[model samples]
Target: MSAPIQLRPDETFILNVGPQHPATHGVLRVKMQMDGEYIVKSETVLGYVHRMHEKMGENRTYAQFLPNLSRLDYLGALGYTHGHVLAIERAAGIEVPERAEYIRAITVELNRVASHLFWFGAFVMDLGGFSPLMYAIQDREHILDMLEAVTGARLTYCYYRFGGLYNDVDDNFIEAAKRFIPRMRKSLKKYDALVTGNIIFRKRLEGIAPVSAEMCRKYGATGPVARGSGINFDVRKNEPYSVYPEFDFDIPVYHECDSLARYRVRMDEMEQSLRIIEQGLEKLPDGPFMAEKKPKTIKLPVGDYYQAVETARGSFGIRIVSDGDKNAYRLKLRSPTYSNMHLFDEACEGMLIMDALAFMGSLDLVIPEIDR
Candidate 1:
């Protein structure tokens, strides 16, 4: 007979980090049980902003449902648009023009920069910094203006077509972007000095949410989350698509595996994206923007097609199943935030409630992307 097993008792408390909390960015609720200020367990509650977007895709025609793409991650409109368009084009066996492919790469890269800038500001703001948010927004507004001139929308742009872009970029747009890049480079320098080097900011982020490379892969995390953990897997580089293979850029990796590492990864990725954009501009080809044979009635073949693109948050995938009909039979979205959030329970354990929020911010979870 064995003696009764004794269990150690530890003081613990519960903390809720909000469905309406400022740091969440959208409707996300995290319930955490804590030992003093450190978390012992945590659960994330979602679906507050669910729109059943995949179901809508099954009912609506491919052309009619274009608007839904941007709504998933409104911050990276080009990234979302590229994923859907690539999926549909592959399903329909359409070829995008050379010029169109270059344009797609450029616009999507610009959108990635804008999205990262917004995240940089918001992440800092979560740690009680405000001025950097304002400066970051100022840089982001220039990107919005540049995108709006071509797409006619700032946030939720529905610009990409089935096989190519909706329209060609004019000389003025390219010139504006060329002018904007130099100014943006100078601004990024200031952002580094102001926020990245600040002692308080570094203190708040260091050693919070430390995840290993094994944990990142097990959780199916990508983008900065995986990169922060020393994984060199960028869809653009590992699985080259469109004009990405032709472009020269670096896949930034950080071994820190902490909140500051994730933050630095994104910042470094922004610099790399800027380089991609510049190279794309220099190599811009002259050709049609949209496929000349684009059909008004897209009757997709009976097959399933999967497409993946790297977004600001991470890799976004679209799975379209067509039944040789005008409308798709099934549409599935494999969003990055969903995969990234799965690691939260493991990362937040034994961390403080404040550190948990910082961890959440570091992952850069866009709730609508998860909920959709």
Candidate 2:
């Protein structure tokens, strides 16, 4: 008979992960308890980049706060803008015209594609492959050019209005988007060849960060994290906001529940977004872009309104508690990355430091979004 080994209860070591770690990709602090390189316990402390967005929204009128949403999630500014604007519209009972809605949907989907392209690059980069990042960004630049032409901005687009879009899509803008899609499709094959099939990347990412569907549900995980775990819930599909149902595209789902699965989901989703954009552009009607009487001064009735949109990372929800005043009484942004990051402790438990970075990359977290 072999004797059982006794271990001390106080045997634990702390490993600080960031407010500066490359894996974190932004300002974030994670205190991890380790048994050697494998994490045993972890706690993430955020707010390093907190700008008090909710509080800021309280003082700004609905239209005035549009630009601020772009600042919260800089990587996916359009998505943030969509969430904020849609929330206000829903609360104020503002109906955007069909043409404007189509434009909004197209732009939002373009932004979603751009965000995923950047993530595809960053995720591969985190896994120690730099080539894919550049390749992915190459495709992303085309969309940025198209967006800049219409929005007068590249990254932070203040182009969404209360009842509709800030401006209409011109002939040149439509032509440019039409020309770009086919080329973009061809380039995706190159991206796949560069990283997806690489033995090293596959080995590193496959079967890692196994987040179960039950775990995702318990933590309120949304977007790719939940979808990666075989959860079929998508705010775009489920809630059906902003002209999404008019387009035909399959919501990509993966049963692997690992980093690789999430990667595949995002890649496939980019294709689906392109399809939606094509359909939106085709079905787009001609009309006034913005509502003529959208009210320069906006006020909502005293009530609470919650709106959720499917962002590049996940579902972003804005909760507004209005007091029938120009300023919001209270505002809360439920960013998807914040919840998606919660599962790190469990997913990273037995992972090495390198594996931990890979897991973090797979979550596709935007630090400001998480910290905010």
- Model 2: per-residue Cα lDDT over 1-372, one tens digit each: 998875476587898988898888898988988876778878888899988888888888877888888887877889989998899888888888889889988998899999999998888888778888887788889899999999999998999889888778899999989998898888888788778899999999899878999999888899989999999989999999988889999999999999899999998998999999899889998888888767678899999999999999899999999989998999899999989999887777777877788888889889888877
Candidate 2 lDDT at 8 equals 70
Model 2 lDDT, residue 260, Cα: 93
Among residues 3 or more apart in sequence or in different chains, the pairs in candidate 1 whose N, CA or C atoms overlap within 3 Å are none
Instruction: Give the per-residue lDDT digits (tens) of candidate 1, residues 251-313.
Output: 999999999999999999888888988999999999888898877789888888899989998
Q: Provide the overall lDDT of each model, using Cα atoms, as 2-decimal numbers.
A: 0.89, 0.88
Clash number for every model?
0, 0
TM-score of each: 0.96, 0.95
Model 1: how far residue 110 lies from native, Å: 0.7
